[model samples]
Target: MKVIIIEDERPAYEKLVHFLKRYSDQTEVIGAAQSVQEAVDVLQQKGQQADLLLMDIQLADGLSFAALDQVPLKKPVIFITAYNQYALEAFRANGIDYLLKPLTYDAFSSSIDKLKQLSGTFSDPLQSIQDIYKKLSKPQYKERFLVKIGDHIHSVPTEQIQLFFAEGRNTYLVNGAGRRMITDYKLETIEEMISPEQFFRVNRSYIMSLTGIKDVLVYSNSRLKINPSFDFKEEIIVSREKVAPFKEWFGGGI
Candidate 1:
């Protein structure tokens, strides 16, 4: 069967290509695409000659599923995604099978077999694609933030972080022991990595950890001021809309 592999990572694309060549005589990869744009172009150029798509959920530019909205493709897709088991129900519901990353040749073959068994084609795949997109768009509740420090990458345990603040264009992470370190992520990106039970983004510039909160002082007109034990020149203020949720989060309503 003619196949198109749509994966963003070069190493992963090469590995899958090598394995496809080695694993099965039933499948033949006709073309390899690195991004949604590339896949769309190849599809528009090749049309129905491309029989199947070995797809990845996340791409370097954006989610791979978003490609469907832009390009009209009817080819069956067997998804390859990093382990996000929360999305399996939607995958199953949508009549598509997914292979978790670090996939073995046997597992890959079995998934293909399963897809072939279930009519060998996906119908309304974009609906499931939309569901996956919706789930991924929201904050994925993760436990820790991966912080890259110089040459070493560290998982700064979420509980150990005191506060996150922005200066100019960079964001800094302050830990419980009064140590500050530079983080590569922007404020909004880091916000998704933190657990809402213990962290709150008070404004566009700051996301403070619960462990760092020393006191909350009521300010003018229902606005609240946060006093963190860490040294700071300006007081952290909570917007009026955030006060209720902030209180609920701080009060352990997680």
Candidate 2:
């Protein structure tokens, strides 16, 4: 089987090449590349003459999926990626064979066997990677919300948000900047989307931006009340269970 490898890291690339050499006498390395640009150039020159592609998900210029988008090649690709929970979902969703990084011989052989099994099967390659990118890049902070008004969409920056409050079954974005928006996401979902370093879930009903914090006051039963930049009808409170985590986040683990 003649194969082309598209990977950016030199050491990892060289190591995989060495491992493939030892894996089988039937497999021949026709060419190798260190970036999506170089890989595309190689594929353009070689065409269907290359039998398979050993690809990496992230490349120097952008995503390796960008290469597949531009190229018309139909070779089966056995992907390599460092294990990340989010990326793993994409790999599984697309019916692609992937080997997690620090590639071992057993894992490499299994992935290749899977690739060889599906060598001629047709598949859609671009959608899964694009989907994951879209999911991760949304909702910069719990404060900033994605607002859609008719055909227009805007990212309301977190600094302008006064507070997030859970009312009934809905979460509302109230802005000190003088606007209010209703979001169809749960408070927990927003917490996961926002950067942990900049935002904290102070209570079941609220997530506050560090920059918006005005002061912290001790309250009964080891609870703490927070006065945030944008005032609210109810005092913002943190539970005792969450206090240690909150301190560690702000104090750098002292």
Candidate 3:
């Protein structure tokens, strides 16, 4: 199979390549692109040479779906993303399968198998994916979180959350009022639950809300330091690699 990968994250791209190589020795990676514009260019120029596309939903420039809009892609796409909210949109844009981030080899293999099986069985494979998508319900983000304090439960709206952080092994959330509470969900799961427009995982340790940001300052090593509205014991620094995407997200560019 001739494949093209469109992913902004270097680690993810490398991992996907590793998985592809493990899946089949015959699978040839024809090309790779990162941004939406680059993806559009690659598809327009090399779309005929490729049989399949392994695409990431979110890119540094914009959503990968925009590339599909600019170029009429006839190739089958398997969208891989951290966020589940775009599943319906992925299916609408000729996506045969949707795989979530931290992708397992089993899931990747199954999606490839499904793509091959569908293509061999049906004349219009993408139509079958769309039909299945229509029957599914749209993904929903968490609106409210229930926290327990001394056998008493309180419901806190998602908008009231200032930030989420991990301490040792436990995850905690701080409200707008600076009240900290423990949550059972991991930072990764919380990342998927929240809207990207409102929340950004500045680092592996912290996920900050836009409304919670008080100031942004340049830190050492080309990184950024975030000052949240609430008090935090540890210094919250954005990783160097995430600086560009953090700036874009902070500026409302994406």
Candidate 4:
């Protein structure tokens, strides 16, 4: 089997290589990339020679999905990531298996075995992957959050939320009623739990809801400033890198 590895961490890459060798002496690693840009370049140049791709979701530059958006890969992929939240996205991108890191030999072997079995059984590899994806259940996003207020508990529906923001080390949720409540979940966790159609992470500090947005003004440095329905002390500005995606999300393209 000829494979390509896309991983940023050195130890993880070395461990993966060791496991591949243990799986079969005939298994050959044809290419390796450490970042999204490198992965794109490598895939464009040597992708045809690779029979399989072993990729990490997070890379040095950005997420591996960014590379997939730029390059069209036909080979089956096995995704390795520390976070389980990316499993749905992984499966959508020609993935046969999604393995969480701190990878075990048994897990690695099983994924390889499954790949071989499926390859031998199905003549159309892409169709097989699509069938497997259809069999897997879809991700269920959070519908409501339970917040404690002194002696009382409040169940806040996700649709009522205007935004989620991080202040210092703590995260807070703002509802449509202009009430602020502390949440245990970090902004990163909140980003994964909410429906993408309704919310977007504008910057590192803020995730804004579509219905809550009052105005979008062109800001300095090619960024965008967001005015929400509720009062917020700090300005909500979309990061320069995220500007394009934010626009797409706002336009319902994402």
Candidate 5:
């Protein structure tokens, strides 16, 4: 996947590059632009050379939405924004997923998967952007879950889960009451089932609830550490690259 990142902030761009290298090795970042006009020029010049676009809503020149009006971008786009207000505009303008500032690997990877799915169905690429949006917009996510415990099967509700964590190869669920139980599904499998508005995947091993985050502490490495309400032995640290989006999600970005 050849991607073009359009972000004005130096740190945010660097952070995304870092995570992309670690998680998404298959994706090659072909180019980057710091402003709206630059992005327009780059996209117009590259045309079909670029397979995907990671665009920022606010650019040095102006809104990215306005910039796209000046040129035709056929590649699938995944929007990046510091605020939630621009999300609606992104969707209308061929966006696959709106990643709030401080993009996490989980969210980024999920968006990539969505883009792949969209590409598989549509032949004209962005021509079916609106169609892809309408198809994926209303998905039937998992509402309730069934958990099995030694000889006794227990049912768990999505609202009660504080977070889902994977250890070694097994996935576990930490409920509202701080009880840990083994789950049959993996983190990747459950990630698709839950609503993004309520749960944010801060790292590879954990997908946490907005309500369960007790405190957000700045780590020594400049990343943010999530202090969950539950008694989790594993440290939950949101990488420096993902801290911004995590904060936005925590603040109710949706």
Candidate 6:
């Protein structure tokens, strides 16, 4: 299928392409647009050529809905976004199925298969796309993880997790007991699995739980430091760029 992608993030765009290729050779990305304005331009010009559109909710200039507002799109759109409850709910009410970021093949394929299945009989498939996503919009954040421990497997609840950390390509889940266990998922992917209300990605290496934060201190360089319940044994510095948002999160979101 000839598709157009409207996304601002390069990594996310690449992931979508990667998963599409992994799913089938029949998929082709005809054009890519970074902002809502650019997406409108591309869609207006290449509107006839595209069979599908995979759109992102947040764009460089504004929301993807702005582009859709100006353009009358007949092609099937598979929405892409970082996990936002409100955004997902909006798509569930108005558009088609949306794929959460750090895109996986299973979700990608399922979205495609459903589109294919609904292609016939429904003269206006996009009209009913909201019903599909609305049905799927219930809170489905990860509750527990099944991990292999030598020859045995264990289920760890979200409540028991203190943080998820990555070191040299290895990801580990540190429990409330301060025990670190290897996990199959990367910190970036794990960030999407857990509720943002309970966990916050402090930096590239750490996704920490609110309850785990024991205290905060000003670091030598003026960056904030978090002392967690379980010993990380690593400096949990809140990066300079994230300080404002971190403060907001620490103080409870606005």
lDDT measured at residue 56 in model 6 versus the true structure, 0 to 100:
85
lDDT of each: 0.75, 0.71, 0.88, 0.87, 0.80, 0.80
Local error of candidate 6 at residue 63 (angstroms): 0.5
- lDDT tens readout by residue for model 2, 18-110: 778877877777877778888778878764787777877788887777676778665667678784443644354343465667778887887
Better of 2 and 5 by TM-score: 5
For candidate 3, list the clashing residue pairs, or say none. none
Q: What digit string (tens of lDDT, one per residue) describes model 5 on residues 121-213?
A: 445545545544554466556888888888999989889999999889789899988888889999999998999998999988889998888
What residue pairs clash in candidate 4, if any at all?
Answer: none
For residues 2-27, what per-residue lDDT tens digits would candidate 1 score against the true structure? 88888988888887887777767677
Model 4, poorest ten-residue lDDT window?
Answer: 128-137
Question: Order of all candidates by lDDT, from best down to worst?
Answer: 3, 4, 5, 6, 1, 2
Pitting candidate 2 against candidate 5, the one with the higher lDDT is 5
Q: Which regions of candidate 3 deviate over 4 angstroms?
A: 120-254
Error of 6 at 202 (Å): 22
What lDDT is reached at residue 11 by model 2? 85
Tally clashes: model 5: 2
- What lDDT does model 6 reach? 0.80
Q: How close is candidate 2 to the true structure, as a TM-score?
A: 0.48
Q: Where in model 1 is the C-alpha error above 4 Å?
A: 1-19, 22-26, 29-77, 80-96, 99-155, 229-233, 252-254
Cα lDDT tens digits, model 4, 36-147, are: 9999999998888888899999987899989888998777898998877676678678788888778999989998998888772345657645644653445558999888
TM per model? 0.53, 0.48, 0.53, 0.50, 0.48, 0.55
The predictions' CA RMSDs to the true structure, in order, are 7.6, 15.9, 12.6, 10.2, 14.0, 8.4
- Tell me which of candidates 2 and 3 scores higher on lDDT: 3
State the displacement of the C-alpha of residue 200, model 6, in Å, after optimal TM-score superposition. 17
- True lDDT of residue 221, candidate 2: 93
